[model samples]
Target chain A: MIVVKFFGIARIKFKEKELHLEASTIKELAEILAEHFSVKPKEFKQFVILVNEVNINKLKMFRTKLVDGDVVMFLSPASGG
Target chain B: MERLTEKTALIIGCGGLGGYVIEELARVGVGKLILVDGDVFSRSNMNRQLMAKEETLGKNKAEVYMKRLGEMSTCSVECHTHFLTEDDADLFERADVIIDCVDNVDTRKLIAKLAKAKDKCFVHGAIEGEEGQVMLVTPDSKVFDKYYKSVDDTIRHSTYSYAVATVGSVQANLAVKALTGKGGKFENKLVIIDLESVFVKTIEL
Candidate 1:
């Protein structure tokens, strides 16, 4: 199982901060969130995704493979400074 | 420690996050500060802006904060009543570190580029409702190039003061750590903060 964490508005949308799910890649994880949140898959493309503390964008992005005990995080954009 | 007592800091905004950043930096003993912001304190800013008070309404944010800091602490503070642009590159040379408290993403890119060119460390912070993040970008890191997209949009109009204060405090802490080379953690990574869940997660760049 992979631990998927949500922050900010993502948490509110999902009604929880984290969950455990079975997934083999970041793409699959995003699909799970997309379905739960009722948002289009394209919407997940703009979010900042990290797998095990490393940004997926720097790795293989959605194609980045996951393993047991892996941790995934979804962070929305923050604009106020 | 007095390590930060002699260092100079440039804070790019004086709004919600910048006000608290300035307060902490001064209280922590940063010797000099440069504040920049073009807007005036409005009724909308009172919700989270530390510099926005009943008497400060219609007053320039940068000037008000500078005066407030001057009276509260011994640190030397300067105010620029305008948004930053290429013309302000010279200010970057005098600063040992920069705290990016600007709300606009395009300005963030400009500050990052200027910091790289000037060889100064840039400490970035941003917030939206219950969410915020902080990152330290040195000349070699090039963090903004990886984290930021060209598209500039802010979803939330205003969030609670609690989140802004929390994020501002973190931003000030990072700036101090960069200046002193102590208590630093997010140099090449981003620290994502969620006040609702009380989670502080750091992601590698």
Candidate 2:
């Protein structure tokens, strides 16, 4: 099972907030988010995806694959300067 | 009397927050002025920009800043009206204080890096909805470079309201206090303001 966390405003939109799923790829994980939460992937694409508390954008961001029990975090459109 | 009186200030962007910075700086008697921006006034900017007016639409930001500040004081004013990135390291090295008024985080991060590399004091500000935060950092802190490791350079958002105006004022105010050294301020921390509830909180990094 893979764990997904949503933060800031995105958390407000989710029913269970964070989820645990059995997805293995970025595409599959996103699809699972849509299916489980009834959300559109397009609207939340810009939100940063974090894996294990590290930004996916920095390590192997965006297209980074997911593994079982991996932790995924969805950041809001927050401006941190 | 464009003589250097106190310290110099470099304002990175002349949008919503930049305009207020200029107005407040002019009012407080900053020693020198450096205004940098690349775009012009559009209809959308008219809502919250302190310097934006109906007649100034389509005018280059640099030109408008120079012309607007010109009316306020005889202090020194230099307007670039262009973009500043790591490539503009010389500009980064020139100022005593920097106030970031740009809209995007990528631009803010780039400026913050250049400022730290030059060992200059960097003041940051951002506004969204009725929420905004102001932070002050030097080469020593990891507020921007360390904390924001995930923000994509290409990602951008378009949000505006009186909240941006109020929150942006906090940024400008913090910048002024950093320049002139007035009021209680944040040097290594950020003050987040929720204008909707009129609540203020500090987030220390």
- Candidate with top DockQ is 1
Off by over 4 Å in 2: A1-81, B1-4, B153-158, B180-185
Model 2 Cα lDDT, one tens digit per residue, A14-71 = 6345677887776678877777668776655756567765666566655778888888
**TM-score of the B chain in each candidate versus the native B chain:** 0.95, 0.88
**Candidate 1: where is the Cα deviation over 4 Å?**
A8-20, A57-59, A67-69, B183-185
lDDT of 1 by residue, A1-81 (tens): 999987654665566778999989988888887887788777777667778878887799889999999998877656787
Clashing pairs in 2: A56-A61, B37-B81, B37-B82
Q: At residue B179, give the lDDT of candidate 1.
A: 92
Model 2 - which docking category?
Answer: incorrect
Q: Give per-candidate clash totals.
A: 0, 3
RMSD per candidate (Å) reads: 2.3, 7.3
DockQ of each: 0.61, 0.12
True contacts kept of 2: 0.13
Tens digits of per-residue lDDT for model 1 on B116-159? 99998988888877888888888888667766763475565457
Docking class of 1: medium
